[model samples]
Target: MGRNTRKRRTPLATKIVAGAAALAVGGGGLVWANFYASAHEDHGGHNRTRSAGAQVATIDCPDVGQKIRDVPDRARGEVDGELASMDSQITDAYQRLATTRRAQAGDARFVENSILGPLKERRKALIDRIQLEINRAGGKADDNLDELAGCQGRPADQQQDGDGQDGGGGQDDGQNGGGQDDGQNGDGQNQDDNGNGVAGPVADDFIDINDVQPNSRNSRNGLAADGDGGSTGTFSTDCGVNENNLFNSDNLIAAPGVDNGAHHTHDYVGNQDNDAFSSDEDLANADTSCQNQGDKSTYYWPVLRLQDGTQEFDANDQGGGAEGNIGKILKPAQAELKFVGSQQGDVVAMPKFLRIITGDAKSFTNGDANANTSWSCSGFEDRQVTDKYPLCPEGSQVLRTTNFQSCWDGQNIDSANHRDHMAFVQEDGSCPEGFQAVPQLQVRLAYDIPTPTVENGQVRNPYAVDSFPEQLHKPITDHNDFINVMDENLMNEVVDCINRGEDCQ
Candidate 1:
């Protein structure tokens, strides 16, 4: 009954059915048209674009997987090279350490402590650097593998020991290299010329002569002798002249004389009584004791040659001709000890006759040869004089045998027992009141003191004599004594001698 009533169909319902049918046909036609078009076209261009896009996307994937695969090989090669270098450096450091130990053993107080600390540090650093490089490489490799395996999201196994823990074992190798750079030798010890481990400023065996500083008092411009008040003269000798004839002999005042008539001498007789001599008559009679005295009284009579090449006969300048004496009273020439030791004496004695000639310092001419006679008995009061002109007496004589000694054996003085007798003289102190101590430079320039021919050939400084081993056997000079007193430690005393002063044995 309901169907019969609805049979009279509604316009809306009919229209809905027609629309649905039309839509189905249109949809089917669109699908058919699409299928047909796809089937007909070759689609080669489209296929290329799609294929290229897919290839690019695949290529963009992370390279971590490949890098992980290579890490083990790279790490092994690098570690091998590093370990080889480390081995050499370690060997060097070990050797240096042994040397340092030996030196310290021989000398108890040797201090070379600065080396050990730096060496240890360097060794540690080298090991650390290697380990760090290894660990970094390993970590990169691990990270790449983990990412590729999709294991990156998982927490790392921190508990694993072999992964990187042992890799840093040689971290101190760098420290060893650094220590070597700081002068620690292969054995990690310092080297010195003395063969001692006590590292100090290096000593030089040879010093440049040009670099040597000149002694202040011995410089060229220092301590010049004054000769303006004296007269320049020459003298001649007469045969068989007695003391009276000797004193009264014309032009004899400045004539060179001899000690016991064997060795030539020079005397410094003053022109005025108060000046140096009492008077011309006194000068003429100065040899009264020897006038007519036997040959035993005669001293060596040497001729005096003046700068002008003139000669004198009597004290009054009475002799005439080229051989005649001049009126000037010849002053004593400054004497200097050119050589000090037996070896030096041998060297000097071979060339010269060892005669003491008197001449004016200013004129460079032979002075009164008789001056040696005056020096014979004179004693030197000043220690400086005794040290230098030990041949002189106090007052009466100009020279005495007691004042002179062979320089080779002259340095000995029992200071431990003879403290009062042996004393150092000051630089300003007098040698003798009349005589002066010549500076070393003056001795070299005037007397031509031999200099060291080779590097470190000899110790030429008078002060250096104190340091000489040979001098230990000789009498100590006043200068040496003074130096000993000032610096007692400089005395290398080896024997049980009284240290009245610093004694070097």
Candidate 2:
């Protein structure tokens, strides 16, 4: 069943401690090693080696555990320095291992000397350091040795902070039956965290091109609406790598509060510090990582994976493969922000923290409802067609494009059901009757996932984001969500651009 769980958070004080196996799996030493015994002679007729090994219960070393639990303010810096260095080393080794594995998939001991051996010695020294700390804290160093040794040889991805899960956003393990999240997500008026009512009913009875003009697939990328019902102008912004502003997952649709992020994982970009516990004040006060010096909004969505059920993240086991687009994750190339449905004048400003969901996150991966998904060659739209996974032309990158509904009932920033506040625009780029029109937000992302094999010129391995919840393991899970965090200044810039009917890029 699709049960919602509140997000759990680790406090600031304890976050400084390094996780276990923070620096293992270097070089050829990653060959799985099972704990064994060097001495069999027992004076008491009972095996000390085997008995000691079974006591390994803690995930981290004993001293490190204490530091992790109660890191004092005065000694926090020293502990942080050690953990930061260890994490850096682990991350670097994992990247190199990934790269080398790409080329040396068959070479078993190729990296044995350079990376693994040194990491082994380094771990020994770290254990010694931990022992010293334990003695200073008046704890038993001898009793922790066996458990500490067992913590060695772990791969780097296990070193990730927090839960050590995928992207630190937590993975959704195919919660609902049939391994699908197709429960109308917002069905039963349960989509959102707020008490608001469900937005308008889900527009069932699927329509095609002639049936509806602008839909999940088309009529986006415009400047303003003309009297003749055509669209003109274009506006866009590129948001690059946002390493700071983030949250792995949150259940709250709009409000940023602690312990309420969704059970599944997501990647957040733009405004730094936009986590589960963040408030509107936290967002407004935070700086942005975008190039658009003025805008400070957070854009997020579920992460995508390749058909082979692999994504280039050091989530579960790091250093598995290296380089070569081994399932590289994708992000928006540009955010196409436009206002539609208005024949004249500027569009009204959207409420801050307004929530939006675009494309059916639960749509089947192929040729249905225009698939509500698009795949194309970079800078090439001619190859974009529904149900067909066409090959990209030489010198072009493959891309996916998606559109969000643009009409609002104007009474709420959100609804109980996740969809009511937003309505799809018409094929003519106009809002539907009775629903007020807002900016038509569109996002097109580029990906470098595994390409299909051509045996006798026939393409294979064609896939799409499969379904919701368990997105990392499926394709055709092409759904995305967003929250409006732009302050008044940037909001007005959007308003002015739409009002002048000039497409500003």
**Maximum-lDDT candidate:** 2
| TM-score of every candidate relative to the true structure | 0.17, 0.49
Model 1, CA-based lDDT = 0.20
Residue-wise lDDT of candidate 1 within 1-505, one digit each (tens)?
0000111222112222222232232111011111000010122334322111111100011112112222333454444343334333332332343234334333323322433334445544544554555576753323222232111000001111231211121111111112121222322232111121111111111122223223311211122222332111111112122212222221121111211111111221111111112233333323322212110111222222121211123211111111112222222232221111111101111101111222111010011111111111122212111111122212232221111111111232221112211221124322323222211111110111222122221111110011011011011111100001101221111111211111112
Runs off by more than 4 Å, candidate 1? 1-100, 103-191, 194-206, 213-413, 417-420, 423-505
Q: lDDT per prediction?
A: 0.20, 0.40
Candidate 1: residue 67 lDDT (0-100): 27
Error of 2 at 248 (Å): 2.0
Q: On residues 1-505, what C-alpha lDDT tens digit does candidate 2 reach at each position? A: 0111223354322232222232122211122111101122333546533222211111121123222333333333343344334433443443343234322223334345444555545555665665555456654455444343222222211222332111121111111111111112211112110111101001110111122222223323223467643333345655663343243445345223423223234556666656655666776777776667566666666544332323333222221111111122344444443333355323677778787766443232111231244546565654443323434545565666666666777866665335666776666555677777666666666655445543321223433332221111122334566667776777777766766666774
Question: How many clashes show up per model?
Answer: 83, 28
Q: After superposition on all CA atoms, what RMSD does each candidate show versus the true structure?
A: 50.2, 19.7
